[model samples]
Target: MIVHTAEVVRYVTAPAVTFEPLRDGASRGLLDHYLATLAVATGPVGLTRMIASTADMTARLLDFAPDALRRIGADAIIADSAEPSGPIIAQHLGVPYVISVTGLPLLEEENVPPPFVGWRYRSDRLGRFRNRGGYRVSHFLMRPIASTLHRRRLTWGIKDADQPLAYVAQCPRILDYDRQNLPPNFHYGSPWRNSPAPLLDPPNGDKPLIFCSLGSLQGARKKLFAIMAKACAEIGARAVIGHGGGLTPEEEASLPGNPLVRAFWPQETLLRLCSAAVLHGGFNTVLDALAAKVPIVAVPIAFEQPGTAARLAHFRVARVISPQRLSVATLVKALEEVVHDPTYRDMASRLSVAMEAGGGASGAAVIVDAALSKLP
Candidate 1:
């Protein structure tokens, strides 16, 4: 419930901006540039932009605190894990806060491998050494964001308390909202539950149902979705595509029809009917596919997607095809392999069981109760 209450855009903003569109109104090559280097290459421009964005959003959120308190009168704050805003705002308002993470538990433990580094979880000395230094260096690069948050706090006349890590580490409760075919042992967090999706009647019988979408921001990639539509058509599967991006008449017209393309679709409800999915590997989409026992053809574009794609492939429930290498032929081939192979489905089902056992929403309630009881 600790969500950004931005009207209309609440569903879009989170841990970070999706590589869906350009920030400066420059559209054509923004995604291309991001996919080329933003995956692993963090540079001055990227870091500066990241810091500026987070700082600006945090201030905006803080601006709303007074109104939010008057309207909701909530006792505590539940913050998204992407930015330090939650903790900062909670501290400013004198309330206890718990973070709800939707991605891998990278910062939860020192031995847990960093996601951006693209390392597998290994307990060996070499792995631990790498993880330790890797986390430190990663956080070092994040110093600018931290500095910005501090400066904003001072501007608001609040005393600084070195609250970033203290806020994260001292969070008596952390809720990981997803399980994406990973080892159950590494799955930390109080589980949040999902309702069983209402199944849809497939338009075509016996054809593999492939649900395709790039999610919130990237859904605007008309070209990529068009390619996916063609691939699905080539393979003769009934594809239902959700265009999360608000494509106008002209842009939507170019999308292929063999795959049903719509401005939007109820993704959770739709996944119930899918045999396989072609996705940009967003966190929610991955978890939904795992829950539905659907194998994935992961085409990671940016953010934590590449890391998620690596893990999914390592788990054998997915085949990774980087956007740079994405072609109709390659996309069709990967989907073919995943659809025909029983192994991916079996593994995906196993993950689904683990995910349910982890106690989705109910587990989160228990943690929140404990956190509250600990207070005074």
Candidate 2:
């Protein structure tokens, strides 16, 4: 996204788990493992895993940072919010740190549903109560890791440190959400890449095209793809399945008709040509489809996917199918509904305009620069 910019620190490797230079569907397993674990998004086990993963990731990055510091004589640290350790590291170095988030900025708010629950946004008292309880549970799960981080901070020469967002009050937050949707504090910048992405050849077919993938994490669902392929066929649609290493060679060979199974494909290129999409409800994929003005059939299998699907469903841009009820018939029905209805596409188009105005990655850079300029 900083392709047009003159000053982006190109770090090929920062986190121990990195995804590939994505073409279409390569499965970088470590990246997928981190993401897939969060697919659950809620629950005691899920929260514990997320805490552990982020803490480990933070430590790894810290080990890598001294080299980065020496190489650049670094000025400031900007971190993805999920990691939470970035700000602390910067604190140890006596440098300002900014947080960048690629999702809703509300975090755990009483008025909104806790993320990934697929609950509608409501101001009702009951909704607030539900959110409060959920947030408390998550905080409880975080205590162990929080305590560990607390000790780590002392070792890092940060004698007094708070949790990640505590720094945000004093730093800029470049958020990947719309101004209309986000609270006032976050600077809304779209996560979609502003630079033009190269395209791939569309699947060869006269039928309405459907793009399908579960993304990298939680993508090893061969059964889901099989159902999607079958449903696409039943609906007289052609699906190009960017399996992301999800399907077997035999499974790919046995796909009924016009279902193109590949390791991956240029997703943006396909989205531009697709009539519909069947996706795992990953936030990035959803934003990509929205930017392309494609309607979606969101089957949320894990993590914040259900919440992402809920947001789309709330916008009337998608039809959400819970995994428990996923079937060829239901999937087919959703495809037909979206492809035939102009409303879904129109809603998606509207979101595209709003998100496009959100300044994408370049906008994010501008925010980061502004944050640095004010640093004392």
Positional deviation of 310 in candidate 2, in angstroms? 1.2
lDDT per residue (tens digit) for residues 88-202 in model 1: 7777777767666666544535555566645666667886798789878867867767776777688766786423211121111221223334323232542243455454654
Question: What C-alpha lDDT do the candidate models reach, one value each?
Answer: 0.66, 0.69
User: What lDDT, from 0 to 1, does candidate 1 have?
Assistant: 0.66
Check candidate 1 and list the clashing pairs.
Answer: 191-360, 192-360, 192-361, 193-360, 193-361
Root-mean-square deviation (CA) per prediction: 7.4, 6.5
lDDT of 2 by residue, 225-340 (tens): 88998999998888889877766798788877558789778887778989999998877777788878999999987666777788788778999999889999899899989988
Give the TM-scores of the predictions, in the order they appear: 0.75, 0.81
User: Number of the top candidate by TM-score?
Assistant: 2
